[model samples]
Target: MAEATEKKAKTKKKSANQTLVIVESPAKAKTIEKYLGPGYTVKASMGHLIDLPKSRIAINVEDNFQPEYITVRGKAKLLKELQKDAKKSDTVLLASDNDREGEAIAWHLKNAIQDKTEAKIGRIVFNEITPVAIKEAVKNPGEIIEAKVNAQKARRVLDRLVGYNLSPLLWSKVKNGLSAGRVQSVALRLICEREEEVENFLPEEYWTLDADFVKGKSSFTAQLVTYKGEKPVLKSESDVNNIIEEIKNAECKVVGIKHTDKVVRPKAPFTTSKLQQSAANKLGFTSRKTMQIAQQLYEGVNIGTSRVGLITYMRTDSVRISQTALDEVRDWISKNHPEDLPAEQIQYAVGKGAQDAHEGIRPTYVTYTPDSVKEYLTRDQLRLYTIIWERFVSSQMNNAKTRTTSAEIQAGDAVFRVSASKIVDKGFYRVIHLLSSKEDSTGSLPALKEGEALSATKFYPEQHFTQGPARFTDASIVKTLEEKGIGRPSTYAPIISVLLDRYYVTRVNKQLVPTQLGRMICKILVESFPDVINETFTAEVENDLDSVEQDKLVWNNMIGDFYTPFKNRVDEVMEKQESVKGFLDETTDKICEKCGKPMVKKLGRFGFFLACSGFPECHNTRSIPLAKCPMPECNGEIVARKTKGRGKEFYGCTNYPTCNFISHFKPVDQYCPKCGWFMVEKYDKKNGSYKSCINPDCDYLHSVTEAVEEAQKEALAKENQALKLAEEASKENQD
Candidate 1:
């Protein structure tokens, strides 16, 4: 520890002419340093330089959420490096992301940097890393926001309490290596619960009629909503047919005409959630992809002579606009879109329970649009910046006005309504009206009072089935988890990634489906530890953590309130020792070589593997191979195995030295129908996507992996989901 301190001291002795800014990422560092000019040097913390040691639950439950954080495993060296940098600079500025976690990182960096040098440490936050924002932020360096730091600490402590206390229960009830979290566990429960609901739902078949109507030259179609204002009182196609028969016999006439002109204002500027949702919808980019791209945009883009942050902070829940940016936007609207400007400045109202302290995400300058940087940015950079720019500008514009006309047709006992809305003025839509598939277009209609006759061409009837709840999309799941207060924004992706990484969940057509292992884990948590997944209990814990952040409560006390009862529950389970077992054991469709029956899964020191249920009789056990290796030389299959030494695992050729091939990679889990060797991915490090074979003995190889591209997207999407879950979990716990 003394040696570590010495390194930090040396780092603090840098000259005043040299200003070093430490951020959470190298990408951000590059962007900021470029904008700040020659006197400034930037470095990355590579994400939290200090964290609670992974080896233990470091919380003082009795001391009002007193946290005992340690330099996290594998981070000591990195922290030492930061300390050295700190000592070498006149002023050390912590420029991590602007969020609770980022604040904690900034605090940790202060300690890490100070341990090396006597140089002053300052906290600086730039909503955007552009030259103007960066300079302004540096000029007005604010003290570290303690509320954010406390919030982060509270969350960490709470997570440790939940994870450390509950994980042991999972080990006993579920399989080893399996664990649960305050956010992750709740998310799992939600998915599992939704899956159950879907399974239980009996789809009801109903019919709907669409009437194609013509008014002179224009033709429009409207779907049947209800019969006599009572929607779907009918259950079957026969009932729908009966309604249609009545409509056919009666003359179609307009009973009531309702027309109203309303302004459809633009949505608030991009909160992390809104940006992610829009990207998901518009670009088919996952939430993770959106953030990764946004991060690049926020950190900085190379613009001719200098690199700059393109957009404001990417992780925020607030819709509050920065006054300067708002002013620029207002000016742009007045000059370029006079008609779209509101009569007065439109102040967007933020939702209740939103974090409004942070500024809404927007481009650094309204004029320095994405197009201006097109030549310098990568493909993703352009797309994301465009989104940010459009969204910000739209947020300040006037509402779109529409002359809406609704016609209620009364056909004897059955009444049907069709509505049309015409854009009176483009308003905000002129700049950034997010076009959705269901958008309806309207125009001036002839003056028609109630009791007017209308002509219709063809009436068509269609059958429909009620859908069960939607499966969690990367976006929907994140939103749902957030609404329920399950987790922080940063955690959403990690939880999802962990589930998939651990083989607990699989994405089938972008939908999360619990694998057998995932299902088993859920069942165990539910049966053995019901409290872990309790909605109110989970939500309360999250709220409690938030309370700690707001300084309304102490972290240690929060942990104590939770850990005391939780520890008791865990201990009780251990002492009582319910020899609870799986009802339907793991089974594989793989044909058993000896026995005719399919192989049944057997529990072992490693994990669930295929073994003859007639163990004593057959005595055959084999690793559940991902795919059979087809390499003629190795003739080995890819099996999930832990690596020795460094614990870094990879697929090895069963043929050993004769076929010396190994892969540290995720398997496609597909077998070569002809060769039988599992195809592995590789990269030249220069080009991109490189798919190869796990068996070293095999000569097969393929590339074009686009590893960074795939990873960036997945990472961002995971981050988004994790963040939502974490935020929700925090709220739930805190409440």
Candidate 2:
């Protein structure tokens, strides 16, 4: 007991003169503590101890738009503990992230605990969490930038004003619980408009003619590009037939050949937008998931003897790299891949409106390659880290070299062309090739002079339809948002998340499609608040926010300029806009079991369902049936349902507590020819809509077009028979 008490006293004495470093996350705190070693005590703030409460707007619109911030609920006790630590330490250093949000956090921390301590309070920041970086930051602490804090405050106050005012109008005019956001509404509009384009698209037919030619031992296919010195525009089967008949037996000869060398440069390192886009495209990760995983990597990961951050700050828009990082990466390449190293350092051009806050996302230390740290990381962590490392190293490497050969063949008046490319040098690709496809496009052909004779083995004409603009996937949407400057680095994932959480958009095979409710809400917001909820105005607002960060504009003045006009628009729309509450409901033939009143299909938080028309008097609701159950003698119907937690859509039997038939895919009213089991509708961007068997052992599949036609005919026949039965039943009731 004496020894234990003495040891505790010694520990207290040891920390009595220590400097305290506060960070946003526990993982980051742990990593920094290891680097700071003995004279410092580290603690995690857990991100934003104080912020505007969620229950109210918390903005004093009348008093120069002052924000009313309170200690975040459930964090009061944590704040008290931090204050106690601050009072004990000799100095407090706020070490959060390296962005506007982080600057706000550091400023908030100084205010929250300054009264409790006589210690010097200052801010310290680094792009990556390493021993050298952390120690160097502690050696030179500076005051928080007031400009960054004001910029964050400006964004917060503006969003609250928009959401708090516009949401009420949405609730009254559209439906209760409906909400609007300054940025998310714009994203919803983009998706809804794209859906409209798709629905209105009319595909037109086109044809391409190709010939398989044999040159000695080499065989290659070439597409006909021109006919009689004009571009071929084959619109129908007759046009293709006419062209084929005119050139079927003409002697084919090579008329011209050209060769050229091409140089392909490496892409810049990952910015927040580029990381999200690349992860979505190559790794099939959503923007939210990509950011989540990236956060984990940036905070820290456990290695052999300590915790270290694997990547630089993840929420940056800059492609800038520090000289230290550049030197280390260049040295690594010189030792490992000497041939790929460039003579001079490479620098990427920053985009027109990038924040340029921190270095682009990259590995903190080049020595910790992906393969070396594979055992310490999760599968996803490794995957994300690998891409970051590759992109950074490749950005500074030499350009790739390739050679291409183009050959033209003439058959009567028709001219066919083919091109082949071969990689002569793999420079940056030495690292980035893992993420890229490795297929060689070169088809070996015999070297021949101009006017050489070639024999045609077969001629084929293929029919195709011009496809409409594709709907936005996670990757494409992020790219579009970045290009249009709709939101900043921190808001991209949250924008998608907010829309999805509110059910404004749903992922249909990884493609974002607005729901009926989503489309209606978008229409209401756009038609009512065009000036505010538009892409151009929103982008301009973003630029103004950036100006505030640069200390060129006052945050309060920016808010003042936007609020009065926006508030007036909201008031105008509320008083004038018509209610669309029951506008989307469809009256159905289903009669409520509780009351004799007919049932109507209404959209809800989950999805569509049948509700009693006599609502307030007799309240009842049931799922709408999509197809009859395929089980023998089951006599049940399949209906759409959502999983409880995730809200993922699935189909199951309406007789759920009784007959348990469920499928992840929606069941169509068609059965497989090979196996007598029912087929379900499935969709993907590559294949469009198709049908697949639900049975695990069966492999039955077919296109949805023919299946839908047959199902519709069957449905019409069933409707007629049901009508005849209903007439007889009515006559009997009258009797």
Candidate 3:
């Protein structure tokens, strides 16, 4: 007993001088450990150590909706390790993220570890992972915010109530494996509604008339704008032809000329929603992919001699940049881009209800340019970081100056107008112009006076049809959700991922298209549980959560008020609706080999599959074939398969164990004429759709390249034709 007491005393003395820090990720721990140096042990919690159980609701609804949190599955060992480390340290710092989720994680860690150790517990948060930032955070630590924890708890309980209470109702009323969410269902409703709008749209044909005219030595094209002193709407070819006939013979003269100088301001630095949208449009990245890459950049990237976080916290909705960051970036501009620097620092407004806990997404260090660290980053990381750097730099630069000219030419009773713009100063555009697709056109109408005679060169009329409402892309959906206040910066990506995983929506040509099952489920939820899947209600609930975070509302009270009506509706639907589990099953033409019974098409968790009608007697199921295998000497048929987690569809051979042929693109029946390889459908948002050879080494792929070139040529031809007409007119005037 005397020896044991001495050892315990020695251990306690050693631990009194030690400190431990816990973070959410190992990458963060490694970077922070380096910054903290010796005498401190840094560890990663790998996210939450405790969460509500997945097997049940785990909420005591009758007892003020108190949550029952247990050690998360597979995290017991991690929790033990964290406690052991805490026991050997005098102080424990919980350094998670800087948001509500992070606050909840820190609170949970403190509660779990405090009982096992005598260490004093505190919380520290830093938007960026850098030596300076870490040292500052360690020097000044704070307690976990109880309000933020309650807000996160409120969101969790609300989601659990909606998901757990409503999912079983869907399984009974619609189909098995069907689920609903507080935010995801509203997103599904948006997509399904858009699909309906598209299906029900009727096309209306219209015509546009353009006239080529010569002014002095310059030629330019103008669109017919006004007829008989009023703006004209040409609805038919006859209307267009009549105007063309009248204008083709009439002597035209310049009637009016106007010039205006305008200044174009730079966009605010990236918020989470804006970053997701920009990455989708510029880099062809999905929202989930964007968030994943941003997380990596926020955690830390290994540079030459040290590890450093490339950007600030990415999951921020505020566009407000810190005064220090603004001053530093302006200094960089004054030194590197002297001509582009503004006289004063640029400030952006914070959006309504923004947390404003962190600054907008920007590079941590201005000197770590994308090129300087390109070798340390993957291709995706480089692209993302480049945009962040450019956006932040440009946000502090002067506005772009442009001069626009508008000319009106009168031909009989028709008025044709041409407008052109020239950049007077590049300013911030000097940096962003490299990323833009728009070309600056200097081809303006030559100096013209009122009543100057102009000769018509050519008349072109084109037919057009009104387009239907566009389907949601990852970018557009995130923008809409943010605008509607349906989800926050962190929830947008996960909401999209959940919808995709549930097979409620599929991406075609990068557009979200609701499946038949998705539409059906949407109809049921919209009709039965209008409050839950409603956009306004969802937005209100988000506001309520924010109120909880601000201490303006009680979390339990909000959940109780919401659950009363929600639970009543669930019970009503459960008692009223008929079972739709087998409603989707349809008899197929193929017969089972063993029982001779006909097969039935049924929806599974992944998608539709062919199953024997006599289930127990002849239990057989097979994937539906899409096309024949494209590989040479392969007799296997290609079948539609889904990815394991996200459920993204791809084509693979039925004999996968042997043939092992797979294609990300859907296979077509036609073979390439040049290479004899099978063709697959390829999609582009602008180019619509086309087919390409599946073989990477096939010459047919070159044909696609040629097609793209031809499209580019066509676009360029339009621009060149306008310039050529101006040149011809200039030459005519000179003669």
Candidate 4:
């Protein structure tokens, strides 16, 4: 029996000698495990095992804003498994993401599992999950950086203090279930201020005169640039008619011609913001969707025999590329497209505010082209990877050469100018032009000499209006946020998402429009917390957070500086601010059957609903009617409703069990002229706003330009009323 026990002890000792590696996700772990084959066990932590609780504000304001970190609920079993594995192994390496949040996660993991085992706990980081990167990280394990962890803690504490304190005040003052954030509030203000601008803007009428000219079997159209030897600003159709009448009988000729050669260089590799904007414009993807797809690409994706990370870290501001990647790409370009290769390698400039923690987003392997791995990826994955590959390869290529020719045509007292460009050398355009909006083909222009006669085919006059500033879309908002330094790479997508999820903003016609409740909330927040909710102050806080990450500033001091004044302001607002809860409620003609009280349209978490005016005495609510159902003699009403889990808005019939009618787009009150089907409002970045028939068989479409004109008129009247109110309020303050 003693001999048997000795053998079992020897077997246990051998088994306990293996090293355990912990990662943030199972996908990453599986890739690393395949790379590091024997004697190394890889397990996933599934993100942070211990984090601040979400139910309440878990910060100690008296203790220099210390956070009360706890094991995230539902993660206790996972933590135990990690501890058990650590107890059996002699070494444990925390291989989470390579960022400040990842560093904090690693630090928390070490502290939690360190006491449970005698194993050596360390940290390993790699931007890309490939065999080379993983092996190198394992060969040189390091400790978690304290400064990064502190920076993450400072941001979390600061956000908690601001959000937790201000949200309740907003609930009391504005409406229940409303929320506010340090960065998100600033974004809200931007949107609301823009909406005010749009409301107050008065569009001026404008006109332009154009004529089609034919010369040598080629036709071209050119705008009249100068009239009567001066630049024209035709503000009215009368002005356009006067010019057209003057130049109608004049002989047109190309009096002068000029040619110039130009060179166009490639753009830098993908930064987080640039990638989001490009995807939004080119692929019609929201920032949130782009990041989600990017995350999957960064994590390991199966390429045939094994899984490998297709791209480097996606959430980076730096445009810097690794030397190893640069060399490989340069070599690949030289062999694949030798003429496009530049004499020297190109390196992009890093931004002023970039921490330069990771290289810019690029493919991990140059040879694994998009076409080679097309079978393994989804359609979106293939498209995104193709662009990344094309961009990286073309960024290091030679400049594209083009020749532009400008012609000035003289007609009576007006000068019409036209220009055309022809590509001299494809260069980088050989690879990148496929993805760019601009093509490499030579422009269409007829060859003409100086003093050549041209025949006018037709005269055209176009009416136009000076458009107001456009509303923010997913692309423009992300670009604006990045330009103003309001948020970081990881926070950009989530900020927009939170606003939409909370009903603070609604996407109308693919443009973010402030709802009635949203505008009211912004008005209150701007008035109550002007100092903390502005862009400059919020940007300063972001800079200070970055400073803490670099160890130049302490985290506790940063939180103290923001929390003191901010808390005082919150207290003052809570005490002094008047409630505007019922101000936005619109009294409707419908009566509540349950309480015999008038029903009013009130804003709820999901959307507008009909609530009884007598709230305490009689509680009754139902979906507000939007339009009549278009089914054949169904006798049902369409109402706005939301989905179960995500609360996404949809319009459906009130008689759901009996009559099944639903649509993602809001139903319009009008019917299609041809098929008699109901119409729905739709918006796209390319097509602007319009109404379309809901029937699959009917293709009736109509532009909403007339509706927009009516809205503008209404907005002008409302603007005058708002100005009068402001003046009265000012007078009251003065008295």
TM-score of each: 0.74, 0.90, 0.85, 0.89
Q: What tens digits encode model 4's per-residue C-alpha lDDT throughout 380-412?
A: 988788888788778999998989898889999
Clashing pairs in 2: none
Tens-digit lDDT track of model 3 for 535-604: 9999999899889999999999999888898888889989998777677898889788778899999987
Better of 1 and 3 by lDDT: 3
Question: What would you estimate as the lDDT of candidate 3?
Answer: 0.88
User: Per-residue lDDT for 1-735 in model 1, tens only?
Assistant: 999998888776532367788888888877777667777888888887778877777777656657777777787887777777777777877888777888999988776667688667889886777777778888877789787787787777777887887777767765566667777766777778777875555445556777865656766666666676677566667887887777775776777889889878788887777777777767777767787788778777678987777787777777888778878889988998987777777677876566565788888878886667889998877877888888889888877788889877766676777777777677777765345434647533455568766666778877555555766767777777667766655666676776767666666546776776667667766765787676677778767766776778876666666677777877887777564457436777777878876788765543467888776878887777766555555557667666778665566655566766556675785543335556654534243234665555566655222333445677789999999999999999999
- Candidate topping lDDT: 2
Candidate 3 worst ten-residue window by lDDT: 701-710
User: How large is the C-alpha RMSD of every model relative to the true structure?
Assistant: 13.6, 6.8, 11.7, 4.4
Residue 576 of model 1, lDDT score: 78
Better of 1 and 4 by lDDT: 4
Flag regions of model 2 displaced more than 4 Å: 1-16, 435-437, 440-442, 585-587, 592-598, 612-620, 630-634, 642-648, 656-663, 667-681, 684-686, 690-735
> Could you tell me which 10 consecutive residues in candidate 1 have the lowest summed lDDT?
702-711
- Taken over the whole model, the C-alpha lDDT of each candidate is 0.72, 0.88, 0.88, 0.87
- Weakest 10 consecutive residues, lDDT, candidate 4? 433-442
Q: What is the per-residue lDDT of model 2 for residues 587-643, given as tens digits with 9 covering 90 to 100?
A: 999899899999999988756789999999988999988787777788888888889
Superposed by TM-score, candidate 2 places the C-alpha of residue 561 at a distance from the truth, in angstroms, of 1.5
